[model samples]
Each structure stands twice: as structure tokens, then as C-alpha cells.
Target: MKKIGIYISGLGQSVHQESIEKYAMRIKNELSYNDTGIQYDIKSEKIFYTQDRESTVVSIFKSKNDSEQELVYKLYDFQYHEILTTKFKTKNLLVKNLILFGLIIKKLPQIFLRIFASGGFDRPYLTFYAFTLLLLISLAIIFLIPVSIETASQLNFSVTIPEDIRSILENVKSYINHFLPISCIFAKIKEWLVPVTTFILLVIPESKTLITSLATEFACVDKYIGNGEQSQLILGNLDLLIEYIAENEPDSKIHYHCYSFGTIIAMDLLFPIGNIPSTNVRNRSALLITIGTPHEFINAYYPRFYNNRSPIMEASLTWFNVYSVADALATNFRKDMNRGPAEFGIKDVLLLPENINYEITSDKKMNIFNFFSMNSIRMHKCYWDTSPNGQSCIRLLFQKMKQQDFI
Candidate 1:
């Protein structure tokens, strides 16, 4: 039987030819050592044309005893890297976006309630942490706009400084009064201009990328979880891929392999709602593999956006969720509050046990910030190379696939 594995990459890791080739090689190597007397070999990979010529396919030869069959891997290349890594051109754009973001944050409570009432999410629906982060950012933006001290001085008005700060303000005002020429020149700078300059100076160095990326990520997360604009665009690609496979390769067995944020996207595709409805693709899928998934992380901090819907439609599908104990972002599906094999209608396998710890080592100097830095985040990226139970994750994946009769 022909097999098609649809690979979805995580945030900012867009699928390209080189990446596809490397992924194909990794799968081939992993499946080669299968103890079940089955071997998978990569023959050739090429971009295959569907009704819409926008799909890449990797052909593999699966052989057992004397029989040989072909398996194809499809790359589900739905792009959002540009959005995630967008750079700000103007300072006004940044402020405008911040204000807009704050407005959206102010409305999240109402939006969450509506979704919760609609039965899309489960109990404990408050997104306290996300709300707090947004609130802080909003407050920071608000703090940027300060009353002009020069304006107060020019009006011949004595600004009522706080008792604790009266001494400092009076000293500063006295110094400014002494340097009247400098004070006059400083006052000529517009009220907004000073703040704008400060904002640019503070943000433009290295923080701009972080802020922009965070803002973009929040916006995307909100849209996707809320089934807003991004959901439609991303899910549309999945729909097209599934439609192509179902129509063109009707007899082929389907597999969905998702990583990191890709798992969330896959979940949305499998258990669709709002603008994107249910599709026959769920019925065609034989297996789903999620590596370094953040399903639990999302459920924890952003409860309202998390999808608590039971995947009853995909009961027949075999799902293998692989995550490392050291990876803070990933979660074991069995331990999730809203998701379990018994509660939901799927066989959720715990690939990594909690006790099984992988030592996190790096050559660089470690610090407190390193815990929250990219080094820690890279833990989620180590699943491809890290082994559990003395076997590579890919090998375990193959074992699971064989157990589920997918191989």
C-alpha cells in the first residue's frame, strides 16, 4: 500500500527543499532499523503536481520479505514565518499596533466567554497569564505618554510633585531654571517627540525584534485559536492538501506528522470548528505523530484559546505524541487535563515517562536568563536527536506505527 506522510513544521521553521530532504533521510534511517523485518528506503523525492501544483512529495520504497511498496511523504507548507518575523518600519506603526493590541486584549474576556458558552472550550477558561502579559504591555505603552514637564513650567504653574519626589523635582526644576537657555531648547522638542524618541531608542536596538515577534505571535495565536483570519488561511492550505490526496491518491494511507506549534494547527485541522468545518481527511488519516507538542502549555496559560473538543471523529486514527521530559514546551498527552485516551476517543501513548530525564548540557556559559533564553527553548527542538529508553524518538515512532498496523 502507498503511504503519504504530511509533515508540518513549527513556528518560524518554514519547509524548504533542503529541510524536506533532511527530514526524508531521517525517517528513512529511523525506519531502516525496524525489528519487524520491514525496511523503508528513500528512492527519489520531487515536487508532485496536484490540481494545484503546490505540493512536495518524497517517494520511499517499503520492502518486507519479497514484497516491495512505495510510500510518499507530503510537506504541508503553510507559511506564517513572515508574519512571525515581521520588522517594524516606523515608530508610529509600533505604537499604533500596541494600542490596537491593547484594545484587543481589553475585549478578550468577552470573546473568551462567548467561545466558552458556545462549548468550544472546557472549565477554568480564564487566560490569566496571557491577559497579564498583554495588560503589562498595554500599561507600558500607556506609561510612554507622560505630561510635559516643560509645558507645566512654561505655563508658570508649579506642578504638584509627590511628597517623596518633591525634593528631587524641585532640585531638577531649579537646575533647569538656572540653565534657562538649555531649558528653552529642550521645551521646543514636542511632547510626543520626546516620548517617540525614547520609544525608538528603547525598542530599536535588540528589543524591537523580540517585541515585534511576541506581538505577532500573540496576534497569530489569538486569531488561530479564535478561528479568525489566520485560521482560515492556514487551514485552507491543509484542506487543499487533504483534498488533493483524497481525490488523487484515494487508496493511499495518510499520516500526519506535526512538530511544536504545528501540532496545534493539526489539532485544529482534525477537530475543526467555526469557519473551518469537518473534512473527510480525518477519516482518511491512519496515524498522527506529534513531536514536541505544546498542547498542554497552551491549555495551561491560554485556557480559553485551547480546544477542549473531543476528537471522536478521529477515534480510528492512531496518535503517537512524543515529548521529552526536559522540554518545558512539550507535553505528554496522557497527562493533559482536557485530553486523555479514555476521555477522548483515541489511543494516547506516553512515549516519554516523567522519570526518564535527558540531561540538558551546553558549551556556552549558563545564567538565570539562559533558562528563559533560546537555549531552554531549544529543548523542544532536541526530540529529533534525543533518544528515550535508549532508542531514538524516530525508532519509537516506527515501533508505534508498526504496533498500530500502520507500517
Candidate 2:
């Protein structure tokens, strides 16, 4: 029986044993009540008092299902690499940006690769997505190349505004003219308003710096996979974990639970750039479950533009993609394919449910914070948490995890 749990993180996350335990405890409490507890012990502090390096692993022992089976699971966090990047980022912004952008060019399409690799090869416009990175690279090169003298020379080109834009501007001018008193009052405070408006815009979802930082960290993972820098980071960590388990407990399969951008890390492990796949470890991974994953979101947005060789991860065992309808990142829940009348010779693509199996559902409640601007934003981070009332999706996942159908 599977026993160990591995937690793969997204951008801006370090391992928080207590927070993770909250998620697991919620599930464990519910399962125990039903007489189906997996009987795993969650731990963060060191067990060996003499040794300095403590165990980050959670030990699952004396399994009720396996007649006293014992095993160890480790909390594997690649966020340490990201933390290092952040710690030293202020020293060299240019090098960091250049490195991240380079990786984005090389591995951004891994998101699409994961979707197609697992399944959905038959979906329409599939070939178009295959060349996603190539198209982006071509466009980037075009933008970066210095223009020739003939093109660089001043041209007799006059930009023209569309009628609608011109009309809107004219209307704004007329409104100000009609409200001259109000306009005069506004002019007195224009200086104050401009900075305030800019501040508000910067603060809507996240500050510009924060957004850029998040993007940089995301690209770092891509670079890690593309360049194989510190290629043994995850593998080395897993090796230590395996050795620890070998000495302490019976062998057990590792179950990885990924969230948000962590799902991207999971994809790299599944369809890894490193020679050592997850299966190479002492106790091979048994299951991969992702909550608030953004793989489907990438597929939804990748097709509109960009052009070649889109990428994918095929599964041997089980992968449960749990998502909420409200989560903005889990956007690819349905496909649109519609046809018009035969005589008219036209088509209208509408909505269709996802074809793949093992996608678990969680109920989502509307959030008040979402009303102002970033409606989809709150859901992206909170699927594992409780909703408006006490709708704990994490608890729901525990129920599903114990079921035979999901297994």
C-alpha cells in the first residue's frame, strides 16, 4: 500500500509543515470518523535527537489496510531553489531576468506538453499548439533584431484612430466642456488624482514588482528543467529521503500532492528533463494529485497565438486533477465545438465537458473580495481551503482519495 506523501510547491512557497498538516489533518479526521483513516503520522521536527539534520518526512505506519504495514513519506519542496533566487535577486536583476526569459523561451510550452502528453491529443487545433514555443521565439527574434536602414528611415506613415475611439475622445472632450465648473475643480486636484489612480492600479491584484517577481520565479523552474542546473536537487533530496526510510521503516510508495504552480513542478517530474524520473527512486511514486493546477489554463490560452512543437506527460498509474469551478487557474474545464446548419455551411463552437477521467470536483462559493476586479484571483489560491461557509475542498479530496474509483 502507498504510504509516503510528497508535497511539490509552486512559486513563492517554502514548506510549512503546520499548514500542510492542517490540510492532511482535515482529511484524516474525516476519514478516521468513517473508519478509513490511512494512519499516517505527520512530522516536521527531527526524530533523531543526536543528529543535527532533522527529518522533514511524515511517517505513515501500521496501516489499517495493510495489516501493520509501515512506511515513510517526505515533504519534498523545490521552492528552496526559488528561495535562493529571491535571496540574491536584488544583487543582479538583469542576469536574473535574462536567465528567466531564456528559460521561458525554452520551456514555457511544458504546460501544454503536460496536457497533450497525458491525453487530449484528439482535440481540435492540436497541431497548432504543437508549435507554440517556436512561434513565440520567432516573434521574439523579430522584435529584437535591429531594423534595416530602409525600414528604419522615417516613413510617411500617419497613425489613424478608429471612428469609435475618435468618437469616444470627442465625447469626453464635450463632457468636460459642458461641465466646465466641475472640470475646473478637477484640474485643481489632477496632480493628486494621477498618483492616487496609479497607486490604485498598481495595488489591484498585486504590485508591479510582486507580479514581476512571481514571473521571474516561475521562469526559474523552467530554466532548472531546461538547463539541468543543479540537476540532482530533487533527486538528491529524494535519495536522502529513501535512505532515511530504508533505515527507519518498511518501504512505501510516495504520493505527491501539488498545488498551483507546484503542478508545473509535478509536470517536470512526470515528464522530467533529468535522466532520473520519479520511478528511478527506491520507493517509486504511486500517485500525483494536483489542486488549483494551471495546466488546463495554459492550454486554453496557448491556441489563440504563438506558433510549433507543443509538448505533453503520459500517465502509467493514477493522476487526480482536482479543481474548483471558481478557480481561475483551472480554466480548461470544457471544449467548444459547434456546427451550424448543413445548408448554411458554417459552424458555431459552444461548450463541451472535458473528456478525460479522474478529474475530481469541489464546490466553490462566491467570494466578496472578487467583486472589485480580480474575481478569478481568490479562487486560484483557496481551493484547498474552506469556502464561504465551511465547504472544505481538502476534506472532499480526502473522501475521494479513499474511494476505489479514484484510486
Candidate 3:
């Protein structure tokens, strides 16, 4: 019997598994009809089966071999006609949709909870009442505060500066005396109105959705980079994704995946030094893909920045940088710049289309939330979206890996 394998991708849920099996069986049936003597087996986290002329092996594999065979089958099916499409064709769309559905399966429990709680009046009413109370309190505070230039200057420093700061003590007293009364009334009025304005702004549904979506995405990758108290979050998320991969494909001898902040954590695991011992697991990773990774510390501004000479870049077994035209975070400033399809003695830096533009203004510059734009929400999170060539870029990546026998 000629052996063929199928590996299912996406979340393991009852509904998703049932649908995948149905589709897999349809494909198997089609192939069986087309080729008389061919035999095939399909397996995923949830299902397994085999079909041939002589006999059928529909029992689930109890051990690791069973899971591996299913994975092989799923991968072969993915690389078949679907990945060959140049545009978003029907079959490709179907597969992409199925994969998305599978991902959704992972979130179904939370989704159902949301649906269940949506109709309840208690939470909504409580939220509204709390918002109203906060608004009223803010208004009262604003009205009571005065807003003169002297008063503003005085109030800003009141908590920090002591009366005994000899040189400026007289100047501070004079400043307050000049502007306190006039500034006080204006400040009060402004304070009363600010909360009302903020409340109105938050109530805008579209703005709220956009903010929520951006926040959700930010939270997903927040702990991975930058500074401050939550720096460990990146390590936690990387560990989570790694654990996910390991749990799903324990038999995968050579695991390869890319990440931004996650790259640092993964590198530490791959190349242990100092007191840390190596995680001596049999299943070692083969490739490391890093996109927009900051190898050296540089200035945060546009004109003033210096790249650090770090050896981290030299250590990667196989690394690829999938960057964007407008990715200011990963600007190339090497001494001998190489451009075009293949440069820097590396294969190619896949530059994706610039799909988002973010603007930073003086007034909104202080808050972290203002850094994101609506376009960022659409471009970054749209991984499942089909590329211009009609294939899901994610699926294409998997296909390319499989074709090269990387997985």
C-alpha cells in the first residue's frame, strides 16, 4: 500500500476536530477514487484514520508514532493544491478559514463566557453607576481648583520643593501672590470639565473598540521588550509559546520558530552560559527566525542613535529577518550596507509592504497608549489574512518549511 500522511493544524476542540476530520475524509475519498491502489492516513491532536483497498485502519494511535503520522499527513495535505494557488482561490480560502476556525476553537470557552454574561444587567448597570460617580467627583474637583499661570507653576512644584530651597523661596512666594487668585478659578473650571470630556471620549464605540484591540495585542507582547517593572512578561510569554510547541509536537526533532523579544529568551535556552546549565532535551531546535530584533541598545529617537557591537547576531545557526519598510524599530545602519534580493552574506531580508503609519504629536506624546494608530491594529494582527498572492502567509511559511523538509 502506498502511504500518505496528513497533519492537522490549529486548536484542538470538539467542533473544530469534527469539521477537520470531515474535510480530511472528503479529501481522502477524492484521492482514493482518483488513484486505485493508493492508501492514506490522516491524524491530528484529536483524530486518526487510514484508508486503502485491502483494509482500513481507523483506530487512534495510542503512542507518539500515532501523533507523528497524523502530523505528517496534515502537513502533506497543507502542501497539496491549497499552497499552490497564486491568489485567494476557493480551496485556499477554505483551508485558511478552517485553520482560523481551529484557532477560534482554542478561544471558544472564553467566547461562550462572554456571550453568557453579555445579557446580564448587574455588571453593566454597576459599570455605568461607577462611571457617573467618577465623572461627578472629577467635575467637583475641577471646579474647586484655580488655574492661573503662577498658580499652575506653584502647584506643579508644591509637592517636590521644600520651603527651605533658599534661592527660589522668595521667587515662589512672589509668583503665587501674583497669580494664585485668578489661576485658582480658571483651574477649578477646567478641572470640572476635563472628566466630562474624558467620559464622552471613552463612550465613543469605535474609539473604544480600536483602543481595546490595540491594548489586547499590546498585552500579548508587552512583557517581551522595553524596560520597567513588567520586563519578565516577555520571558513568560516565550516560555508559554515554547511549551505550547513542545506539548503539541513532542516528537518534532528540529523545531524552528521566530520571535522579536522571544528571540532573546530562546537564544538563552539554545546557548546557555555562565552558571546556567543547558536544557539537555533530545529534541533540539534547528532554525531561529528573528524579526525586528534589537541586537544592540540604541537611541530611541530618529536622528541620534548608536548601534552596539554585539556577538548575538553571529551565533544563530540559521536566522531570517522579516522586516518592514516603515519598521523604525529595526533600522539598518551597518558600516558596509548591502541591499537587494540577497545581501550581507545572508539570503534575503523579506520586506513586507508598509501597511500602517503612526503619528506622534506634542500633546499626545506623554502617554504610552498614544503611540499606536488604527492602521497598526489592522496590519500586525492580520496574520490569518490572505496575502495578495491568495495564500495565507502563515500557511505558506509552513508549506515552504515542509517542502525544504525543515519540519
Candidate 4:
């Protein structure tokens, strides 16, 4: 029998330990295949375990043994080397070099064109143009030069958007739209230019700095929903959980199962700093399972731009996204009942009951009625139920982990 430790977060630290113990026991009973004892530990972080203790520990870090750790480090170095080599050969670098060469060739043409256009060969203007051309070439070369994949992956692309400030901007736009006469030429120009200028500013790197300042200003707004802050908090907790598992059980591997916000946090950790660590230590124990996660939300928010790839997609990791039609949060759950499986990238498995109105509330009550009733018709509520569907889903998740040789 393997000793498994399960860690759960999201629930605050004020939660009673007795409740956690009971929950752990129930989970253990549900997943029991033998005399496996699953221990549950609740902290202000997220972790999950099963009946296989040794495997769990190994999943947390690269290796328990010194030889394996050394090998992992060496493998990481090799991957970095590969990234550098590949980057040097990329089309972007070639294009940049070609552009610089083209600029050099056109130097005389530019000078002649300027001289003819301005009625003289002005040395100062020619020098300015030359300098400008050099500056452009230099910038192109610098940006086009490919760095190691490890280094590229470590780049931060996240931008924080404050709701209150956005609201203020919206209000200003609205006021401008309403009170400012659209028929007036100046007003029309302002309307067109405002959005264009905003778009251009956002494209600039300095926008991130401005956003940070704005976010600080709106920090005290009571109605503000700090999704970015929440994301960071969840990410921090995940890192802590991973570090804990790595420290406590060096030989075991870590597998993750997540739902909603939990899924987002999992992605953040797996794809930290825009790079997925290709080391065996990182990949060995990496199996991700996401439930009811809005992976498409980022795309939806941005429209026609699929910028946010799930960490599962970025890394060489095995993943399963479980979704149900009965969950309101699942994409298009209310529109087409059969669409859930397809939307979630899981076509074969249907976890929700057919034709069940997830929005409807039932009169039947129990001790845990509040928990289940909160989202009565939604698939999210199904997790709280001790039904076979939920049980099977949990069991199958672990079973898949085992099949991946994680156990």
C-alpha cells in the first residue's frame, strides 16, 4: 500500500482540521483499490495526492537520488544549447540581416532621392538619415537575434488590467460619445483618434508600466475584482505546494488535477516566465488534469487572437480536460448539451446527465444542501455530490495518471 498525501487550497486557513480529515477519509474510501492509506493535508496552498506515495513524491521534483538530479541539470543545459542553435538558424534573424543589407544598398538612392526632393544634397539631413537607418538596423538585429529557448521562455508577457481604471476609461469614452457632438468634425476626429492612440499606446512596452501605476491607484476600490492579484496568489500557493512536495518527497513525481481558477494557477506554474522548463526533473512528474477551465476565455477576451496557450499545450506534458454539459461555466453549456465534450477537447467522455437543466433548483435538502445548492443546476455543483459520475471522473483521473506510469 502506498502512502499518499493530498493537499488542498482555495479553502482559507480558518477551515477546521476535522473537516479536512473527514473529507480526506471520504476521498480515500472512494479511491481505495487495496489497503492504500491516503493522508490529507490542508494548507493555504494547492496539492493533491492518491494512494501511491513514492510516485507522488517523485512527481514533485526532478529526482530523489543525486545521480538523477545531476542528470536533470545536465539535460536542462543541453536543452538550452539546442534553443540557442535553433534560434540562430531561424528565418527572423535571416530577415533582419537581409533588411540591414538592403538598407546599406539603398543608402545612395536615399541620398539622391532626398537631394532631388529638397533641391540640394544637404549633408546634415543625409547624416541624420544615415543615423536613422543605422538605428533601425541595430534594433532589428538585436530583436531578431535568437536567445536560448530557456532564456526566451523566462520572458514575462503578463499585463495587469485594473477594473476600476478601465471603468473610468469607459465612463470617459461614454461621456465623450454622448455629450460630444458626433456631427462636429473635431469631435469625430477625436473619437477616431482616441481609440487609435489608446491601441498604439497599449502596443508599446511602456503601457505595462502605466498599467501598474493605474492598478496602484485603484487598489482601494471596493468593487474592483483583482483577477490578476488573485492569479498571483494562486500561483504563489502552487509554487509553495510544489516546493514542499519536492523537499519532503524527493523521489516522487507530481501530478495535478484542477478546476476553474485552480486550472489557471496550474497553467501559470507549468509555464512560468513564458518558458516551459524542459528538464526531466520538471517533466518527469508532470501530468495535468483540468476540469471546467475556461482555456478559451483569454482568446474570447482578445478575439481572433489565440495568444494564451494552456501550459499543458506549451510543455511536453500529458493533460486531460474534463468538462460537463450540466456545468454553466463550461463553454456553451446551456446552448447545446452535446457540445461540452467537444469544447473541452474531451470527446469520448460525457460526465453530466443528459437534458438536466443546470439552472433549476431542487426542493430536496440535506446537511450539505448549501454547498450543492449554490450551483444546483451547474456541473460545478456535481463535484460536491457523492454521485457515481463524480466518483468515476476522480477515479479515472488517477487511473490515467497510473497509466502514464506516474504511480
Q: What are the per-model numbers of colliding residue pairs?
A: 0, 14, 23, 13
Top candidate (lDDT): 1
Question: What lDDT does the true structure give each of the candidates?
Answer: 0.54, 0.44, 0.32, 0.36
Report the alpha-carbon TM-score of model 4 versus the true structure: 0.38
Candidate 4 lDDT tens digits, 1-407: 12223223111111113132333333443444523543222222223422221111211122335444211100000001121123223435344355444444544454445444532212223233333433333343333222222223334546454667545555654565487552454445545445644543444434333222222222211011223434444444445445555565566555554545345455556655334533433734455556554443322221222233334333355666655544433333222334432322212222221211222233333234323222212234344334322343445445554555544
Off by over 4 Å in 3: 1-70, 73-206, 209-251, 259-268, 271-277, 281-283, 291-316, 326-378, 386-390, 399-403
**Is 1 or 4 the stronger prediction by lDDT?**
1
lDDT (tens digit, per residue) of candidate 3 on 38-150: 45555544222112111112222212453343322332211111111222233332243333333334433433443345332112222222223323333333333323223
Name the TM-score of candidate 3: 0.35
Q: Where does the lowest 10-residue lDDT sum fall in candidate 4?
A: 72-81
Clashes of 3: 23
Question: TM-scores of all models?
Answer: 0.58, 0.52, 0.35, 0.38
- Which runs of model 1 end up more than 4 angstroms from their true locations? 13-18, 35-53, 62-215, 274-279, 306-310, 334-375, 385-392
For 1-407, candidate 1 gives per-residue lDDT tens digits of: 65777877776322222244456666677666553666666654344434544655666667654665655344344444443334432335356457447655666675466444523322222233334344544444544332244444445336665665555555666776686654555545455555654664454353344455445555556555654555665677677777777777767777887777777777777655433334557567777677777665566445455345444544466667776645556665443332233222212322222111223343444454443243434465575543222334666666666665666
**RMSD of candidates 1 onward, in order:** 10.8, 14.2, 20.0, 22.3
In model 1, how many backbone clashes occur? 0
